[model samples]
Target: MERWVGKVAIVTGASSGIGESIAEKLVKAGVLVVGLARRVENIEANAKKLATCKGKLYAMKCDMTKEEDIINVFQWTTKNVSLVHILVNNAGGNPGTTLIDGDASRWRQCFETNIIGLLTATREAIKIMRDNNIEGQIVNISSVLAHSNWYFPTINAFDDGFV
Candidate 1:
C-alpha cells in the first residue's frame, strides 16, 4: 500500500462491501481513489469520514451496465487527474435466476453488468495504462459463485455465466 502512494486507483461499486473497504484502505495508504457507483452519495459520505487520510476519495456516479457511463468515467478521470494506475473491477450483481426457470432480462442484466461492464472498464483502463506507460494493475473481485459446481437447488440461483 505504501508503494501505491500518489497513484490513482479506480474501484467500482464502492458504495458498499469490499469496494468501500478497499477505497478506505487505499486512501489511508496515500493513493488517490475514485469510487464509482450509481449511489455516489454513499461514497461521498464515506469520503467525508476519511478527511484525515493521506490520500483522497472521489465519488463518481457510474452505472457499469451502460457503456456511456463507463466511458465518461475514464474520460473525466484522465482529463482531471493523471492516468489510472490501478483498476478494480469490483462492480458485479446477480439475478438469482435458475437455468430451468428464470427471466431472460434478469440473465441479460447480470451478463451486461458483471461480464460486459467489467470487460469494457478493463479495456479502457489498459488503454490509459499503455498510453501513459504507467505499469498499471487490475484486480477483479469475484465470488464463490464463480465456481460452476456450487449450486443450491432451494435458492434456484444458477452459478453459470458468473465472473
Candidate 2:
C-alpha cells in the first residue's frame, strides 16, 4: 500500500522466519530496510531476494544483546538512510523445554536474548527517534508464550516490561 514510502525501518533477527517476512513486507511497501541479525550471510541472501522493492536494503550483522552493535546499527542507518520510521524487534526464540526440565543456561540465554536484547535495542531506537524528533512505529514481535502458562515466568516478565 506504499504506507512506508520514504520511510526507513529496522528489523532484528531478520535472517529467517517471521523477521524475514516482516522485512519483505516492509520492502514491498517501499520502506528503506536495515535488517540486523547474527547471521550476516543469511540476511544478505534475503536482501538479495528483494530486488523488486523501490527502497534501499542494507543487511547488517548485529547481535541484539550487544549494546555497541545496536548503537552502531542505529548510527549507520541515520548516516546512510532517512531517519528510522519503523523498528521491528523480531529477535528471540525458546526451544521446547518445560519449565522444570529446561537447562539453566538455556533459560538464561532465552531471557537474555528475548527480554534484555529487545530492551536494549528499543532503548537505542527511542534515543534516535527522540533526538531526531522523528515520530516512528515500533512493531514488537512477541509470542503468545509471553502470556500463556506454557512458557517460563521470565517470558511474562519481559512482555510486561515492554508493555
Candidate 3:
C-alpha cells in the first residue's frame, strides 16, 4: 500500500538504529525520504541503498545542535522538493552519566542536544510547513527513561520538560 506516495519526509539521525528503521519504512511506503544526520558518510551510504527502493532518497549532513545546519536542511528540501509532509525528530541519546558523578557540563550537553536542539528543529520545521501550507507530521522520539521512576542519577537530572 503506497500510503505515502508523493509525500516528502525528513528523518533526522537517519544514520543508524531506530532512525534508520523509520526512514526505511517511509521509503517503502513511497515517501520521498531525506535522511539527515551528523554522520554524513553513514547516511550517504544508506541513501545509496535506498535509491533502489520504492521512493527517492536524499542524504544530507546535519548537526542537530546547530541552527544553521538545521536551516540548511530545510532550505535544501524546500528548494528541491515540493513540500515537507513529515519530520521525524530522532537524533538524541543518553549520556550514561549519573547525576552524582556527572559534571555540570555533561548535564548541560544532554539538555542542549536533546531538548534545545529538538525545539530548534521543530520551530524551523513548523515555520516552513506553515509557510508552504503543508500539513505535516512531526514525530519526536522520546526515551522510556523520561517516564520511568527508576532513580538513575543521569535520568533524574533531566528536566521534566524533556519528557
Candidate 1's C-alpha lDDT? 0.86
Better of 2 and 3 by TM-score: 3
lDDT of each: 0.86, 0.79, 0.79
**Stretch of 10 with least lDDT, candidate 1:** 154-163
Clashes of 1: 0
CA error at residue 126 for candidate 1, angstroms: 0.4
Return model 3's CA RMSD, one decimal.
2.2
* Comparing 1 and 3 on TM-score, the stronger one: 1
What TM-score fits each model?
Answer: 0.92, 0.84, 0.88
Best by lDDT: 1
Candidate 2, lDDT over the whole model: 0.79
Q: How far is candidate 1 from the true structure (C-alpha RMSD, Å)?
A: 2.1
Name the lDDT value of residue 105 in candidate 1: 86
Summarize candidate 3's per-residue lDDT along 21-131 as a digit string, tens digits. Answer: 898888877889888888878877877887787887788999877888888888899899756888898888666676677767766766767777788888878988888
Off by over 4 Å in 1: 154-161
Query: Tens digits of per-residue lDDT for model 2 on 33-152?
Result: 999999979878877888777765689999876878988998998898868888999998763354555567766666777877888888888888899898888888877655456634
Q: Give me the runs in candidate 3 sitting further than 4 Å from their true place.
A: 1-3, 159-162
RMSD of each: 2.1, 3.2, 2.2
